[model samples]
Target: MLSIDYQQLLAPIQQFLQCETPVTWLDVAQQPAQLPILLTDHLICELKAAQSAMYLIRRYAVDEQSGEALLQWLKPYEDFTYRQQGDWRALADIKLKKSMIPKADSGFGQELIDKMVLLIKEELHHFYQVLEVMQQYKVPYDKISSSRYAKGLLRHVSTFEPNALVDKLICGAYIEARSCERFAKLAPLLPADIGAFYLSLLRSEARHYQDYLQLAEQIAGDAISERVAFFGKVEAELINAADTDFKFHSGQPLAFSAAVGA
Candidate 1:
């Protein structure tokens, strides 16, 4: 593995977001007792990230055939994550074909397909990596509810055309950036191999956020600084607010604090 000056890598990411991962959340996240839920949520987060990318491509960029192909490509992993019905060992060989047909004459279609295909590939690979780590840690697979974090950001999306797509892309940027930030914060606090794996993800995660932002700008065809800042505030508020649920992307854990007090 290559050496990283994490401080150097994370500086811009830190500057982009409105706030940091709360120390209180980190305190609970690193506990041994919290590992099960954390790993489970982390695993699902990877899957959801891939699904989000796939959905974006299918809805806005690809033809119907390509869209169906995308869904089929993702099905096995979805089965494993959602139904626990497949072998994790076999996922490494799963690959998205290179010849996806783009929607006819759409300006952003090809670009969206290019960027999102790569994101979907990386995210699915990460889904497998997390599952491998879970197996090593003896964390059994179990379904868990998503945290309010994503919904909180998405609920604000404009219910109009290109605005809706642009908003979704902006929200994707925040989600990736926040994931990268939390991974950096929690990596050193975890056990060695897992810490290294999380650290290994920094570059791609950072790039994923940038990719989403660039796509957002391209789709909107104007300066999105105002909208980006708008989401920065929404994302920060979500991160800062207290929550009973504790997932990988959860806000501060009120439930954990209450347990400790009791």
Candidate 2:
């Protein structure tokens, strides 16, 4: 089994997230008192984002028609969390599969499948945990605008066949890596309870990033370092640049004082 040098990557990951954490988020994160609330929101975003990738795989990258099924699988959780149309007890009963994609003779397929399945499972579990925390803290759920981070990086994808797929997978790698990095950066700044939770996520999150990278390599069958660097630059731009949205992955603060000021 292939393994990632998680400890080795920690420093770089930390640097990426902390580099441009926008002065805007500092105040919110510094409020150790509100760490629980902020972290709860962060966790939900992570799960939903991961679920999106799962659907992408089940839809475009995998069996092609499994996309609708993937949506159905996530519908309950989405309705409960985002739409508020379902109950928590209903979510507890939801049993999404660990691996919707199967293994193949190439070894590449199975490796990607297994790793991503673990990621989706962990992400969904994290979502549930966030809801639990929110319920305990009496925090109300609200819809936040989509972050520019993912879209910015994704825009660089080549409009071709396997090249597009390869680029998308590479973009996935950066997203996962950046998320792991952000969690590490924010952990120490958070309250003890939330900090512990963030630290706990470091292990699996780091592995998830590596998993995406490996999948990119397996599919491309060549040196993806240039491609990786290409997306890294794009991703860094999205993070280092200014933005109006306030999200877990949003860039510079847009002065939307309404959300923070409120």
Candidate 3:
């Protein structure tokens, strides 16, 4: 069990989420055999988070050359995750390399670069941490299809400029909030070392959720409460409804027999 007040850490996230994770999902997550799949998905989630943050910065904040540098910095990890050609050791040097991010004239641009660069750094570090845990446990990394959770939320993104950006940031907030909430939920059920690691991640994840929300509100330049509520409902439905697959963010697990029968 974690020695910290996890509920206190998660209070804000819990308030942000419209619904709690389903009991059925929690039941399945507690099983010992689910660890490999959980950790593998978690490892990928970290990379995806970093990649998303990088894209936001590249598309809105940085110059073309800086964008290329960002891609190069992420290339080794991506190669390993996607192509399975590179070793984990190749990711070590990436942590030390810093890319230049030129300041943009627009306030939103500079703000995005500032916040997202720090987010990218932390997420990449977390990815490495997940990989370390996976290696220790002999959990091989394999590409798995993404959970329906994110795609469901993203389908609501507006196909325009600032609205698109604002909606994406809102989605980012929900994703991070859910991730933090799930970590707190899962930590106690995991073994000592893994539990401690998950607990260690809470502080950063909390900050990330806040960062995304702040950026969304700032970019929107008005009350985003309604839009936030809209996405909250969408996110809650995804969390609460029945789901067939057992991903880190998947809903209630479909019974094996049910799947076989289908």
Candidate 4:
């Protein structure tokens, strides 16, 4: 069981989320057979999170050449995750040098670069950690279709420039907050070691959500409560409604009733 208080850990997340994760999802999550899929999705989610942050920085904060360098920095991990071309060990010595990107002229640009770079670093580290845990459990990595949860929220983003950026940040905040909330919920239910690992991730995940929210506010320079509320409702719908697929962030499983009937 987790040593920390879940309510305290999840307070901010709960406030941000419009709804809680359904019990049906939790029931499916507790099944032993679900471990492989759960962990695999988790590993992928970490890498994807890093990739998203990198893209945000590269597109808005860095110059063209620097953007290419950022791609090069991420190539190996992407290759490994997508094609299984290299082992996770190859990622150990890789370092993101400061010279890869030029200094930002605007305060907003500098802040985005700084925060997103740190986020990428931490996410990749967490990806490595998830891979290690999968190795320990003999869980093989296989590509799986992404859950609808993210896409559902992303579909609501405005196509306009600053609005698009603000919306993406808001979406990021929701994703991170949901991740933290789920980690707190699942930690105590898992085995001791795994539970401890999940608990350990709570602080970083919470901070990540906060970082995204702060960036959104900074970029908007005005009250973003309306947009935030919009995404919250979308996120809550994705969580509360029935989902055909089971993934790390998927909603209530449609298979639940079938399993019960069987």
Residue-wise C-alpha lDDT for candidate 4, range 182-233, written one tens digit per residue: 9888887777788789988998999899999999999999999999999998
Q: Which stretches of candidate 3 lie over 4 Å from their true place?
A: 1-5, 96-99, 256-262
Off by over 4 Å in 4: 1-6, 100-105
lDDT of 1 by residue, 1-262 (tens): 2245877788888999999999879989989999999988988999899999999999998889899899989999999888889898999999876477788878999899899999999999898999899999999998888899999999999999899999999999999999999988888899989888999999999999999999999989999999899999999999999988888988889889777668
Candidate 3 lDDT over residue span 1-262, tens digit each: 4444877778889999999987778777877788898999998899999999998988878788888889988888889999997778668777525555655565788778888988988998999999999988888888898899889999999999889999999999999999998998888888889988998999999999999999999999999999999999999999988888888888777673254347
TM-score of each: 0.96, 0.81, 0.93, 0.95
Go through the candidates in order and give each one's C-alpha lDDT. 0.90, 0.67, 0.87, 0.87
Which one is best on lDDT?
1
What lDDT is reached at residue 214 by model 1? 95
lDDT of 2: 0.67
Model 1, runs deviating above 4 Å? 1-4
lDDT assessment of candidate 1: 0.90
| Candidate with the greatest TM-score versus the true structure | 1
Which ten-residue region of model 2 has the weakest summed lDDT?
Answer: 98-107
Lowest summed lDDT across 10 adjacent residues in model 3 is found at: 252-261
For each of the candidates, give the backbone clash count. Answer: 0, 1, 0, 0
- Indicate the residue-level lDDT of 22 in model 4: 83
How far in Å is the alpha carbon of 17 misplaced in model 2? 7.8
